[model samples]
Target: MTMGLPHGLDGTVEGREYLTFRIAQEEYGIDILKVREIRRYEAPTRIARTPAFIKGVVNLRGTIVPIVDLRMKLHQDCRPVYSEFTVVVILNLLDRVVGIVVDSVSDVLRLSDEQISDVPEFEGAIEVDSIEGLGTVGDRMLILLDIEKLMSNVDMGLVAADA
Candidate 1:
């Protein structure tokens, strides 16, 4: 079950098939197929009256994209951005492109299907529905993100039309 990007970029890439990033102290990953590119942190144009979780919007090569603060979205404490504390991951979902702000990007990682495990039910502030699974890498655990659910769960029209 391989997913294909709009421009024909295979969801899986050689050497690395997953785009790994960080939110707070936890590691997370999304299928590379959903990722368009990664950019250094940039201040977005703030849109008044939008949700706080939606940081704002940014211009990417002439395309206006919404930017969501992962920290705030995850209900974590907001903090000042440091030189290495912020990154924008460009995502392509349902032919629409958007940018999400993360605490930092780690590295691309490749994991076999066997290496990925279903997330055990746990009580927490983080929404379990957005998690695809959990992948183990040595001593670390990577939370696999269900990009489709995350994107679809939000009202795209609201974000697209406003902030």
Candidate 2:
């Protein structure tokens, strides 16, 4: 007798999925579900007295979403933006939506359980606390990020609503 319908008969890879993007020269990934949409880079409305990492807010289809510069967050040297090297990755966190500015978007990739490995503990040079895991794709490595922690971190304050 045939045992039920076998697992994942529809050619599905069981594991977390991510949308990879570039910050500086490194590659990073975030949960695909948390990503609302990706849009071309646009100048944002400046907000005074905010953190340097916060680029300000942007009008996303009418909603004002705060934008964070990934390079600044990662403590990387900022480069002058060119036509194609800028992009914005919209995120949905804690029922609040925000946009994160990144250098460029790579693509959406599926990382199976077998493809992901635990993140290595790095010294003071790099902090692995915000990283979920590491996924290897061919010759490239994608640093999977923990969206919840990254958004909720005290420094980010992404969930803080108007008082």
Can you tell me which runs of candidate 2 are displaced by over 4 Å? 1-11, 76-82, 124-127, 160-163
lDDT of 2: 0.79
Itemize residue pairs with steric clashes in candidate 2.
none
Residue 138, model 2, lDDT: 85
**Distance from true position, residue 20, model 1, in Å?**
0.8
What is the lDDT, from 0 to 100, of the residue 105 in candidate 1? Answer: 89
Q: Per-model C-alpha lDDT, please?
A: 0.76, 0.79
Error of 1 at 44 (Å): 0.4
Question: Model 1, stretches more than 4 Å misplaced?
Answer: 1-16, 155-163
Best by TM-score: 2
TM-score of each: 0.80, 0.85
Candidate 2: RMSD to truth: 4.6
Per-residue accuracy of model 2 over 1-163 as CA lDDT, tens digit each: 1232223766554666689998877899999999999999888888998877788999888889998887777664565363677898899888888888888999988777777899877763235777889989889998888866766667778775332
